[model samples]
Target: MARYVEIDDVRVALAEPVEVPPRAFVGRDKELQLCRVAWGISSDGTELVDSSAPPLNFRLEGAPGLGKNEIVYEIARRLDMPLYIVQGHEEFTPEDLALLLTPDPEAVYGEVPPLTLRASPLATALYEGGLCFFDEINRVPDRALSPLASVLDGRQYIYSAMTGMNIGPRDSAARKRFRFCCALNPSLSNEGHVLPEYIEQRTLPVIEIDHPPFEDVHEIIRTSLSPSPDFLVAFTDWYYEQERQDISVRQAVALMNYAMNYEQHVGGQKTKIFDQVASFVVGRRS
Candidate 1:
């Protein structure tokens, strides 16, 4: 007699979660290489061991839609680290950096808890030896930046009011463990926000990226197009020439998808499809 044990259905075995593709952004090889260099400096123990040695910090500044954020994402990806994104804004405060008080469940209904809250997710991640991606860093107020000065210098550590504890005196290992990176739009004469000189001093070796070359832009479109086809590149180039301006490759990919869907349901006419794409691209500018 053969004895057999029942097995769970293979289909019932949960499939590995699909990795979502990162957001579409165009080329920035030079920026990415500089980031890698900074990352290497941060990871090497000897670099930070000497108190006189400067810390490794980077600022990536560029025009809007130039892939600053994407470079940060890619650096974290390549390093196999988690990314914590903090979006900077004009109203950002110290509470946004260190902690804020919140209503504790144990507290009386009318009373607020006195203890400090955990820093923003990004700050906590930075203290915990992870990548912190601060977007639009130039927009944060100067006063609010004081709390981060020590951490940025690699000399001060974060103090969590929630735990009544200091997070660092980062061991050599911890110093070599984490990295901080930021992205921001360059401050043009017309821009309202400006980063303080102190904050500016902390960020070194600024890297700037530009919109990708046409070939790279075309590749981004091809990769993101839902129904991949060889002709997609040619079509995208034509659209770009006709428009006489560049929108994100992401926008182009989206327009292609929308046009394809419209063609299938409305009519297969190429002119109709082109019109739909034009509405998304050129029409937006007008």
Candidate 2:
């Protein structure tokens, strides 16, 4: 069938999904390399399709705001394919993983509006050989992930009851190009998130992203806020020491940002802005 075939009352998006590069994906070259390996790619830009265990899936584990989303953005840009994203949460349901039939935007309410099959990222990636990133996947409940187990396992297909379609790579070339990966927050478990073991086993290389080194963190701050003062970098790096486990690259940037917004309180003293940000926001969590 054609990529954009209209089957029955449903219309599939045959064209590749849109891909936008991340504006400031700072660190994690090593993590990106591991993801490339999981996707059957090698250091020298060769495909390892014939490997003994050729599985193109990954589960990226890290604390919130440690640049997990940024890694996938880089991968999508490198692959030069369509990027599909599915956000996971407590209320995530199996139906959310398939094609959704919604009122067509082009049709008005009075007219007989054709229902458009708002295809899920899972199905879109499978159909068009693209990258699918499941953000905060651990937040999704056990039942919601059942459909995912089949896709990740030897079955290599997902049955969308909404569209009554079994979505998978159309041919060998499509299969070789499609990639799937997930980002998970370590704290989600504490928030009562349960990852189904079947899905866990199907996934490989649960890569853990720890905080970047002091130097890297400093550089990230410097590069992120070019023409920034040296004191800002020194102070931010020092603040990081106070919350080794709690702080992240994102939080550091926020502090700089918060400081800038609270500049009026500093009376034009740039360094004093740091104090305002630290003290202004209590119970700060990233």
Candidate 3:
């Protein structure tokens, strides 16, 4: 169920954060440290030297499936805050970033106002001081992202014309706690989906992430797959030795998951299982 909060005299349903079960997170220590530094968070989890300055908003640039979202999730988990995510798309509008009007389920037909305002994830984060991540930000049309200027800047708020309201932190504490981050593929820059200069300017200290090393990948697979197969070592070695395009962490996980399922079904020999998974998962016919 969605929770409701009163913002500027208007009742708005807060957007729920993305939820996933706790899992062992592997590697990306450098990237995680970079994000922590950018956010003014210290090694001990305390706000750094200047508590008065609001945390800087940063953008994570990486290829698809490279654990960009996982980085954000890890940060939110460490901070123990709600993580509101707004998935970017080509058709997003300014209003979509702030508020939307939906038919009121409880309103009496033809008697009371038929519409209720719901806060978007970003707006809910702003109002409630939660962490908000805009994924694949480059996919959102430039026009739809115009409203983010104020929200990302020192002003630290967004004005919604629909309700004629300025939605932001309710108090100093909320302002201090509120944080924002975004992720997008830099490759999209050449594909007519480049970020606006102002946006690029406001979202500072851009963090560039690449695929994790093989050792980390091995750890990820070992940790993610419970009671990992004994042949996992052979499979990882084969994957690294193959002269094929590098797969993202997600693809690697998927491959291992398929291999586990295959093992369960066939109860095959180790070598055969590896061959089948490699052939099916990576399109390499053994």
Local distance difference test scores for all models:
0.60, 0.71, 0.82
RMSD of 1: 10.8
Ranking by lDDT: 3, 2, 1
Predicted structure 3: lDDT: 0.82
Query: What TM-score does candidate 3 reach?
Result: 0.90
> What residue pairs are clashing in model 2?
none
lDDT of 2 by residue, 145-231 (tens): 988987777667777876678777767876767778988887877777857788777777789988877667677777776635755
Range of the 10 consecutive residues with the lowest summed lDDT in candidate 3: 44-53
The all-Cα superposition gives candidate 3 an RMSD in Å to the true structure of 2.9
Winner by TM-score = 3
Q: Give one digit per residue, the lDDT tens place, for model 3 in 116-185.
A: 7888999989988888999999999998899899999878888887888889898877888788999999
Better of 1 and 2 by lDDT: 2
Between candidates 1 and 3, the one scoring higher on TM-score is 3
Can you rank all candidates by TM-score, best first?
3, 2, 1
